[model samples]
Target: MSTSAGAYTYSMASNYNRVPKSKVVGISGSEVIELVKRRLLKTQLVKMFRLLQSLFQ
Candidate 1:
Protein backbone atom coordinates (compact mmCIF):
# COMPACT_ATOMS: atom_id res chain seq x y z
CA MET A 1 0.00 0.00 0.00
CA SER A 2 2.84 2.35 0.77
CA THR A 3 4.47 1.65 -2.55
CA SER A 4 1.22 2.25 -4.35
CA ALA A 5 0.71 5.53 -2.53
CA GLY A 6 4.24 6.69 -3.35
CA ALA A 7 3.83 5.76 -6.99
CA TYR A 8 0.51 7.55 -7.24
CA THR A 9 2.07 11.01 -7.11
CA TYR A 10 4.52 10.32 -9.92
CA SER A 11 2.24 8.15 -12.00
CA MET A 12 -0.73 10.50 -11.75
CA ALA A 13 0.77 13.99 -11.91
CA SER A 14 -0.23 15.69 -15.12
CA ASN A 15 -0.12 19.49 -15.51
CA TYR A 16 -0.36 21.79 -12.52
CA ASN A 17 -3.85 23.06 -11.63
CA ARG A 18 -5.35 20.10 -13.45
CA VAL A 19 -7.50 17.78 -11.36
CA PRO A 20 -5.61 14.61 -10.71
CA LYS A 21 -7.35 11.35 -11.64
CA SER A 22 -6.45 7.78 -10.81
CA LYS A 23 -7.76 4.27 -10.26
CA VAL A 24 -7.35 2.10 -7.21
CA VAL A 25 -6.00 -1.12 -8.59
CA GLY A 26 -5.69 -4.52 -7.01
CA ILE A 27 -2.57 -6.52 -7.71
CA SER A 28 -1.66 -10.05 -6.92
CA GLY A 29 2.07 -10.46 -6.81
CA SER A 30 2.89 -8.41 -9.91
CA GLU A 31 -0.39 -9.20 -11.65
CA VAL A 32 -3.29 -6.79 -11.65
CA ILE A 33 -6.76 -8.31 -11.49
CA GLU A 34 -8.98 -5.52 -10.34
CA LEU A 35 -9.35 -1.80 -10.91
CA VAL A 36 -11.80 0.87 -9.76
CA LYS A 37 -11.68 3.88 -12.02
CA ARG A 38 -12.71 7.44 -11.27
CA ARG A 39 -14.55 9.99 -13.33
CA LEU A 40 -12.77 13.18 -14.29
CA LEU A 41 -13.69 16.57 -12.89
CA LYS A 42 -15.65 17.70 -15.90
CA THR A 43 -17.79 14.59 -15.82
CA GLN A 44 -18.33 14.91 -12.09
CA LEU A 45 -19.28 18.57 -12.38
CA VAL A 46 -21.74 17.80 -15.12
CA LYS A 47 -23.34 15.06 -13.08
CA MET A 48 -23.68 17.32 -10.07
CA PHE A 49 -25.20 20.08 -12.12
CA ARG A 50 -27.70 17.70 -13.64
CA LEU A 51 -28.68 16.39 -10.25
CA LEU A 52 -29.20 19.91 -8.97
CA GLN A 53 -31.36 20.78 -11.95
CA SER A 54 -33.47 17.71 -11.43
CA LEU A 55 -34.00 18.53 -7.78
CA PHE A 56 -35.37 21.96 -8.66
CA GLN A 57 -37.69 20.66 -11.32
Candidate 2:
Protein backbone atom coordinates (compact mmCIF):
# COMPACT_ATOMS: atom_id res chain seq x y z
CA MET A 1 0.00 0.00 0.00
CA SER A 2 1.40 3.40 -1.03
CA THR A 3 -0.02 6.86 -0.60
CA SER A 4 1.60 9.94 -2.05
CA ALA A 5 0.52 13.45 -3.01
CA GLY A 6 -1.09 13.47 -6.46
CA ALA A 7 1.02 16.41 -7.47
CA TYR A 8 0.97 17.96 -10.89
CA THR A 9 3.55 20.32 -12.36
CA TYR A 10 2.47 23.93 -12.76
CA SER A 11 1.93 25.01 -16.33
CA MET A 12 0.78 28.26 -17.97
CA ALA A 13 0.47 27.56 -21.70
CA SER A 14 -1.35 24.32 -21.10
CA ASN A 15 -4.19 26.16 -19.37
CA TYR A 16 -3.93 29.45 -21.18
CA ASN A 17 -7.26 31.18 -21.85
CA ARG A 18 -6.35 31.07 -25.54
CA VAL A 19 -7.20 34.40 -26.99
CA PRO A 20 -4.57 33.78 -29.70
CA LYS A 21 -1.58 36.08 -29.86
CA SER A 22 -3.05 37.82 -32.87
CA LYS A 23 -6.35 38.30 -31.11
CA VAL A 24 -4.54 39.64 -28.07
CA VAL A 25 -2.67 41.99 -30.31
CA GLY A 26 -5.92 43.17 -31.85
CA ILE A 27 -4.81 42.12 -35.31
CA SER A 28 -7.60 39.68 -36.11
CA GLY A 29 -10.89 40.89 -37.58
CA SER A 30 -13.02 40.42 -34.49
CA GLU A 31 -10.47 42.08 -32.24
CA VAL A 32 -10.07 44.95 -34.66
CA ILE A 33 -13.82 45.44 -34.81
CA GLU A 34 -14.08 45.45 -31.04
CA LEU A 35 -11.23 47.92 -30.75
CA VAL A 36 -12.89 50.27 -33.21
CA LYS A 37 -16.21 49.97 -31.46
CA ARG A 38 -14.61 50.84 -28.13
CA ARG A 39 -12.67 53.83 -29.38
CA LEU A 40 -15.47 55.21 -31.55
CA LEU A 41 -18.02 55.00 -28.76
CA LYS A 42 -15.68 56.75 -26.35
CA THR A 43 -14.76 59.52 -28.77
CA GLN A 44 -18.35 59.99 -29.86
CA LEU A 45 -19.46 60.46 -26.28
CA VAL A 46 -16.65 62.89 -25.63
CA LYS A 47 -17.49 64.89 -28.69
CA MET A 48 -21.14 64.99 -27.75
CA PHE A 49 -20.27 66.31 -24.30
CA ARG A 50 -17.97 68.93 -25.77
CA LEU A 51 -20.70 70.05 -28.12
CA LEU A 52 -23.16 70.26 -25.27
CA GLN A 53 -20.70 72.28 -23.22
CA SER A 54 -20.14 74.69 -26.06
CA LEU A 55 -23.86 75.08 -26.61
CA PHE A 56 -24.36 75.98 -22.94
CA GLN A 57 -21.24 78.18 -22.84
The best candidate in terms of lDDT? 1
Writing each residue's lDDT as its tens digit, candidate 2 over 1-57 gives: 112112232112121442211211135755534321212345556877999999999
Go through the candidates in order and give each one's C-alpha lDDT.
Answer: 0.62, 0.37
Error of 2 at 13 (Å): 42
Error of 1 at 19 (Å): 6.2
Clash count list over all predictions: 0, 0
lDDT tens readout by residue for model 1, 1-57: 323355565466553455545556667898986465644778767877999999999
Candidate 2 versus the native: TM-score? 0.32
